[model samples]
Target chain A: MYSSLIITNNIHSWVLSLMPAAVTGITEMMMIAMIYLTVFAVLGLFLVLMERKVAAWFQLRIGPNRVGFFGMFQTIADALKLLSKELTGTDKADKFLYNLAPYFLIISSLMALAVFPFSENLQAFDINIGIFFLIAISSIGVIGVLLGGWSSNNKFALIGAMRSGVQTISYELSVGLSLLTMILLTGSLQLSEIIEVQKSGWLIVQGHIPAVIAFMIYMISGTAETNRAPFDMVEAESELGAGFHTEYSGMKFAYFFLAEFINMFIIAAIGTTVFFGGWLSPFGITESIPWLGVFWFLLKAFALVFLMMWFRWTFPRLRVDQLLTLEWKYLLPINLFNIVLMAIIVWLNFTIQF
Target chain B: MSYFSDIYHGIQTLLTGMGVTGKYFLNSRKGAITQQYPDNRDTLKMFERFRGEVVMPHDENNEHSCTGCQKCEIACPNGSIEIIWDRQVDPETGKKKKMIDKHIYHFGMCTQCGLCVDACPSDAIKWAPNFENAVYDRSQLTRVLNKPGSKVRAGVE
Candidate 1:
């Protein structure tokens, strides 16, 4: 199944041929990682700006429009301000873990970004276990929250960090379960293979009810995993005054901040690839232009991103007990039942045939 | 028995809240409730009855209605208004006249309470609708209400 989807079987060999033997296989992977880290950082800035503008619109207010035309440079200005800030820490803070926290978050999300097959030939390191890798690596971000909160030596930060840890663990079940439901349809855990499985039709439209249920569960759990609003008790600014990252300042704080938007992008990107057919043009409409796959892929992902933002602005933050109840009593059970229902549907041969 | 129904209601209410916000977001053509303050300054008009600051209106002849009675100065709670006056003999009537030298208005101290406007005996001072009162220097905020070279309106006294 994976053999035919290997886009760079020759390309990898070609790179090895051209490069000096001293430069090992890790060198090629490192090069890919370095190039994409810069790309994702730039992409992170735009996502932050887009989230702010969406939040403003939902509240019937004009958001930042001063820095540049429609506040286009607002995030750029914010990045500059964060850069110039002095890095501050408490006198009693565990300085090592305190500083290491933000890097843990940023590196994990950046790793996930590399696995995204944006188009047929677009992805880097199309790992065999892409979905499994994404689920496993993305969960590591919560450690940063826990460490940042604990190391700050602040009570609220510790409470926030604990809540974040608990929330991520519980919701991780639902996110994995939801994706598993879709993985049932695709068979292969490889992302490109999953996208290929949707060649007949997008999963949401083809599988209908069970697929929609899975997508809905995926979105809610994804929102929780990213620690967005409503589920954002981790950094609930109103109560905790920015939670775990409260004591961080300067470009260090900016790392924690940018990683958040990047996490949101990763969730949206996975949502797009799994349910909306990755880079496969919808209904094969724009199939002629292969590169348009990237456009279609981003368009779908951003739409889901917009939906997540809508959930943020419209809903009130959930209380801790209520948040836990939402996961344990609601999403987890529903996701479990949804997986079984989907398997039954697949066995019954009732899914829409293209 | 009611457990499933409770979940349904919760989902329903959540969707309703989203619908209201979704309506506003889609109707963004109506624009946000926030007036882009700096951008819309030219077209942004205050209400006709809006009172911002007190000003003594003057005609092209540089004549105003203040009799230098200091009524407005007395009415000001914060002492934001001061009337500068001197006694000058009225040549025509052969009587001493209390003519205004200047009416110093410290906009920095003003609360826009309208007491000064209400207390002016000659109707010389009234509220100006314009309210953009920002200034770089504190001294620049103390304005001369009586324009330079302006005298009292001929028969206002």
Candidate 2:
């Protein structure tokens, strides 16, 4: 149904008409990079502002209303302030790794952002192994945290890095397994194909209770993966000061901050893609208006992001031991059992659809 | 079984916490716990007994009840109150009486203890709830409680 509205293809052909093949390819890559960079910056600012506003509501206080109408420009102003700040670091720190750490995080998150099929023909990269690439790229951010912490030459930073390593390593299994559970029903790793399968109904509906269970597991692990609150061991300010990025300053610190929100968006976007039908309109209500798929996609993703933010505000930071216990003891076992149960259901051909 | 129960209870409590926060979040405008201080200045009311500052009330006639008693001066723990007195003849009685030349109140030194107000025999002073006491100059804080060209109220001992 969405085949006729192919905008990205048209743009590619238009560019190709004017330039040689290699030059056109290089130009397209540059344009895509610029687009992703802008999206990353805008999403980071918006999410941070949303977080502050959501936090205020939970605490029953008016938050960040003085800068712009409803504090719209608060993060923008904050970004400007961070830009002007001095890039300070420890005198005896490992300068190479410390400088390189934030790029690992930013680049990985930006790379993951490419595979998301925002709408039909709107995706920058449509890799056949899209979900696999996302899962792989997502894990690379932990290296950034590790390098940032280890190279800072501070004990707390190192401890935080270690905690992050342990946390990410364990929780990554849960994220992968949970998504793998859904992969059984969709039977394709390509994000577009997964959404295409969901044209009959969202995976959460078709896969029934097992999908719901997997979604819960995915969300819990996803929050930990992002190093957000309740799983914020990596930046436990009370214990580890500012954690892995403690020594980072100026735009260096901003890079880490922006990468965090972008990572959060990626997590939410993946959940939307796998379970909520990516950019597909609900029951094909707005399927004809293919451009509106971006709207549906963002709406679902932002809803999930809000849910994550709610988890952050409502829940207390998990004690380091409790964090592991919950992941290993509860999420992993349930995830394994759920995966088998899903296999049985799919085998029986008992999947429900609208 | 207890392990399962713990998980159940944990999820229950977590949901309960989220519910509370969610309820507040939805009605945040109504349930806001903080006041916009500068914005709500007109409606911001201090309690009647709120000891914001010390003031000697004067009538429309610009007459005060100080009577140059020096009781407040003695009672002040911080020595914030200073009363300069002069001997004057009562116009009607032709009797020598003590009258205040200047009721100097060093707000900078006053601790809002209300001791001076308590010690005023004629009930000349009381707390004024105008707490916005900031001033650029230190000298500006040392206020003369009694206005210039003002007289003591009649029928005081």
Candidate 3:
């Protein structure tokens, strides 16, 4: 299965052409790690800057335009500043776990980034059970939050970590079920295969009402999973005062911040791949330009990202009880019913295919 | 039924809230109410009645309208005004007259109450709208309203 998918242009093939099989394999692994690391750092900086700009526009303010042309270099400058700051830690805290927590969160997020098919032959890791891999890896991020909070020896951090644990555990259900509903439409867990299935029409279009409902549930749950605003009870500044990573400072603190934006990107990327066609041009107008698939993929992902940003700015944060109520009382039940409705539609052959 | 309606209304309210922000985002360029202060200095305009600082106007001849009445000095609540009047022989009149030696304004201590401006019998001082009053040295804030060698204009008191 993996052999046929290894095309000519990727790093694996390029490295194999240059060296003997044993040497090439090792070198390819190193090269891929370097590439993904660079992507992680670059994406973290870009998404932070994008979030700030979107937030400013929504609030009727011009945000961070002084650092560079339209503040393009602002997050870069911030990352540099964070690098130069002193790394502070709580004196009595569990130093080992505290140090390990940030790495755990960031690594899990970066691992999840592997399965997203950005364009044809562009994915870093195209595992067989791609969506399942993403779902499993994303859940691991909350454990990092838990460790960071509990090990900090601070009540606020502990409370935040506990909230995060509860939120992610509950929301993960809806996130999985919603994708499960779409899986019925595509009938494949492989992301590349999912895109191939959408050759005729996107899942959202083919599956129609049920897919839309699933997408909505997925977005709300995905946002909660990412620990972002409106669903951001974990880091609710009014209550927790910087939350689970509050005791962290400098580059260590930056790891948590960077992981957040990366998680957000992953959420948007999954939404793009599953609902909208991963890299399929709308109406195949740009079918001649295969490279343009990356442009369309990113365009759809960022549109969903912007929608989340819109949600962040527009809505007030939900109370802890309300947050749980929303997930348990509303989202989970609707999600279960939506899955049944989708299964029935698939059974009856009622999906609208163009 | 209420549960279904709750979900319906909840989504409707969320969409309505999004509409408000989306509208502003679309018109953000013109709708942003923030004023970029230093950047817009050239285009910034202050209202006519804005009381920023007390200023004594001197004509091109270096002559002022203050008749050394000492009314403003008496009216100032904070002792921000000091009038040093001395009996001088007026060049034209050749008679001993009360003339201002120094009109010291301790702008650092001024409350901008406009009382000094109001109490000026000859309307000698008025508010200037130049609000940028920062100074590195404390002495820079204490200003002499009358320029060196500036004399009272020859006019009816």
Tell me how many clashing residue pairs each candidate has.
Answer: 0, 0, 0
Candidate 2 similarity to native, TM-score:
0.87
Docking class of 2: medium
Itemize residue pairs with steric clashes in candidate 2.
none
Per-model DockQ against the true two-chain complex: 0.58, 0.65, 0.65
CAPRI verdict on model 3?
A: medium
Tell me, per candidate, how large a share of the native contacts it keeps: 0.72, 0.82, 0.82
- Across A187-272, the per-residue lDDT of candidate 3 in tens digits comes to 99999999999988999999999999999999999999999999998999999999999999999999999999999999999999
Q: How far in Å is the alpha carbon of A195 misplaced in model 2? A: 1.0
Please report, in order, the local distance difference test score of every candidate based on alpha carbons.
0.89, 0.92, 0.92
lDDT computed for candidate 3: 0.92
DockQ of 3: 0.65
RMSD of each: 3.9, 3.7, 4.1
The C-alpha TM-scores of every prediction are: 0.84, 0.87, 0.85
